[model samples]
Target chain A: MSVSARPEVRPAERAEPAGTAPQPDTWRTRLRRDWPLLVMGLPMVITVTAFWWLPTLGNVIAFQDYNPYSGGIFGSPILGFTNFQLLFSDPQFIRAVTNTLGITAFQLVFYFPVPIALALLLNSIMSPRLRALVQGVVYLPHFFSWVLVVAIFQQMLGGAGLLAQTLRQHGYQGIDVMTNSDTFLLLVTSQTVWKDAGWGSIIFLAALSTIDPNLYEASAVDGAGRWRRMWHITLPGLRPVIVLLLILRLGDALNIGFEQFMLQRYAVGSQVSEVFDTFAYFSGLKTGDLAYGAAAGLFKGLVGLVLIVAANRVAHALGERGVYSKS
Target chain B: MSTTDTVIPAPGRGGPRRGKRGRAPWEEPGSLAGRLGKGGVIAVVLLLVIFPLYAILLTSLSDSRTVNAAGGLVLVPDGISFDAYRQIFSDTVVSRAIMVSTGVTLFGTLFSVALSVLGAYSLSRPGSFLHKPMLFSVLLMFVFFPGIIPTYLLVSSLGMKDTYLSLILPSAISAFNVVVLRAFFMNIPRELLDSARIDGAGEFRILWRIVLPLSKAVTAVVALFYAVGYWNAWFNAMLYIDDSAKWPLALILREYVVNAASLPAGTAGVAGYGHSVPPTLAIKMAIVMVAVLPALLIYPFVQRHFTKGVIIGAIKG
Candidate 1:
């Protein structure tokens, strides 16, 4: 959030060079220099304020004993800490916390390394044409709407799905993980792997291509085997990219997905499917408890903020610029 | 050099003669076994991605019986028919959804891109009026996410319920898009903009004539990103617009195609899968195809801009 800035030249004026440029000795001069840019920014200011900043203020409802029958925020009884207290006391909220953490952890472990592996493999391919073809096919899923992804999955593995029916024709009972709520976690995680891993590998692939190829040649001349060369040179080259994406992932860890869970919530039931986002939506709409939902959402947002800062600090400690630098 | 570990006979290997047929120093893993291993992994991944997509196309075009037999996906393409697509288009509910989605994507992308361009151009120059605060505010959004409940309440309270504005206005600007566009804008030579200023050209004129002309690639990329975003977004529609008729194609796909239990009541009789020419699954697959089609078409054209997009996006937060 830190800003390093130089003054902009207003269109109305002929601006001089940086060293000799006019600095406003008075507020009027500053205003004269600045107002046009402000005018240009007006639409965006309203857009951000109304959509993001204003709604952020609505989180104050979390501290109220909110009832929709009453007027909004001020009209509701002010119950300090009660809504949050109720949220923590509820068993459903606890399950949602677990589900959110569980999904994020599963993705961090199983889904995180997939892109790196794909990038390495892509980098190793001998023929450029074949490599491009593979890259094309793999990244296609990244653009799909999650609903479409869920639909395709359902069509594939639901009880009446293609494979399931094929198995039935052979007199074998078919497996339908789409309907099997017990394995829903694994199914969803695999969907994430299928949908995103290849697309995610792009940054790493770009990073890999930028590595000085002569280093590998030099290492080979030193009689270092392919394995040793990879571990020493290639991995080190990919480290900065990997760390950047990893830090970004930590900031987004709690986002352990909403649309996927929302689409599939009916199949597995809310208990298993409810993450922080779906929890907010379901409680607010389905349960008719806006205040409680806001409380849960606020709690998640605050925790996410804290975790991102902490993760960035750790990344800084590890010598990678995490997202952005303090300077 | 080290045991010649690979069975691969490097086609371009420079034997003892370094000058005659010297290989680039960087090329490695020229082993036959290694090549086979890498090829095998890539082939499997290719299938993993392609298989379902192939099945979807086949299922959408397959005659109803084959589609039914396979449950919903076809193993082979045969007796291809456009009946599913025809049926979907003929149905007003689905057709309207498509229209709504198209309208939203077009209008939303246009408005969003316009706003983002103006904002990015203004912010690209450092120390622009309120630049620090504006940029800092956007960066903070990455941390302090406004939640769904609050957002939903705000929109509903604003009387935007069931209106298309709810879908478009809330997502009018993406900070990432602004940052990327700003990066591109700033990369335009300062001397060029300065010369424009010296020529008595106004800020807007310079942006439109000089700056924008040079930034066509990034502008196209950012525009496509917004279009794709507006097209794919259904969550806002779901939360704000309860009228199914006003639903975007993505939401309709979610409801009728994906959610078997919640298909529109009039379309199906007792079976719920709807006994029809293009079977339920075929129609569902058709819906999925239509939902994914525009992106599939546009992505390859803009694919070259992706590396630039991602790198520029990363340059900020």
Candidate 2:
């Protein structure tokens, strides 16, 4: 069961009883009571207005033939869905879409279970100190930037890196794991695992530790082997977290990240490396085609929104606490 | 289990007894072979994770002469040289970048914490005006990320381009951090607040005297999260800052280490330093270390609070 941390606030319940609610004096008293709280909220209100709301309003350009020469949103000519139509018609955009989904799918297949495996392995070790040390070591790479991670992989396995040098010394051929277009999926996914698997296991380990010890003890007394105990008790205990994270992951299927690809795109060539974020950056920001780029972004945002909401509903239907409760 | 079952407990009773080496009480005492096997797995995973660190350190320290001899990456440490650490510290470009990064992280974290703490506090009270709308707005940002182009346009148009504020403000407050902080704030017992209110304590007084002090652990965790974020930021610099001299350490490290490119001219000492400089390999690895090392040093201290606070606040909040 999830521990409730948020004050389950219901705005409707907080409203005053209907009828006989019209007085300047009443609002004044309410304002007097709430003005201090509102002061605390001032920075957030300003920030959200400037950053979130304004940028959201800037999405208007996506529907317009926006020009830098023109004064932004108001001055731009309307071109409803024209930019989106052009975006979809481009072969490069199609390539980006395919690459995005392809890499995301590969990560889901290969990288998703890594943390679960890690958490289970870690839980099996009875020594708390050992578990902590291993955890510290493995969780470390998560803090490293994607640039550093890609660099680390290149340093170890690139054409002129340690493995390649050692192979050359032993009279073998060069290694090109870092720059090879064919193995891009494997290399990137491994980097993802190396960077995130340990960190991801934190929640799973938290979940694992929460399982009642008596369950394990009872199962063991019932003549279950270690593997059988794990399959029956441990696995069941982790199901909620697994489902929760899976739903979240499905929601984020489009966000495969950008830095790794951007850093490596030169080495592997853009042919195999272009994803939506990079494509958006290249097409919009770098080339000064804000409207077209915004269209691509808007499309991605729409899909992501639908995906997350649907995924949350599915999680609720399956009796899992996905991200938020429906209330 | 390894105590030879000498206590001779009744059937169900023995399942909860002490076992050797702190094995689970219900576990069959692992055989010597089994323990060794477990240790071996841990060892291998540790080696795999740590091997890159060793390689980078060794390469950074290896005497410039022996580095090429030892195959691109220095596999073994031989006659450790401080040339790399010395060079980057001495170099103007890298050192300035380090200063820039420190400034951004310190200021950025402070700004982020202030905004998030205030916002979270404002949203924590259930019946406050605009509480639900504000909270839902924040939550909606998570589902529908503002597109990169529009965000860039907004920041640029607002005259944040090339400014340090650009580094700090565009991504100033994280939704996750806000949610976590709000969760922590909300968890403060309602009765405690009510009692404080009855004692004539205003919301601000209660927040400062009671809430802030009580929530130190979560506060530190959120602060560190923002600090690390600011330190690791390069994409913002790439997008907003045009002046090469304004580049932060992460951006510099990205250029020198990841892209394997030399710093552009006018950056610092690199342009004028003709020939006698140390090996580029050592310099690159040293930058990598510089980028990564601070987090390592600071991690252990914040780790306890970080794990506990983030798990409870983030997942549950």
Q: Please tell me the interface RMSD, in Å, for model 1.
A: 9.9
**Between which residue pairs do clashes occur in model 2?**
none
Say which candidate scores most in lDDT: 2
Checking candidate 1 for backbone clashes, the offending pairs are B8-B32
Candidate DockQ values, in order, are 0.33, 0.32
What lDDT score goes with residue B102 in model 2?
A: 97
In order of appearance, the predictions have TM-scores of 0.90, 0.90
The TM-score obtained for chain B of candidate 2 when compared with the true chain B = 0.86
Whole-model lDDT values for every prediction: 0.77, 0.79
* Model 1 per-residue lDDT tens digits across residues B114-220: 98898878777664557677776665665678788888888988999999999999999887777677767877888787777757777788889998999888889
Best by DockQ: 1
What's the C-alpha lDDT at position A110 in model 1? 89
lDDT of 2 by residue, B30-98 (tens): 789988988898898899889999999888886567676775888877788887888888778899899
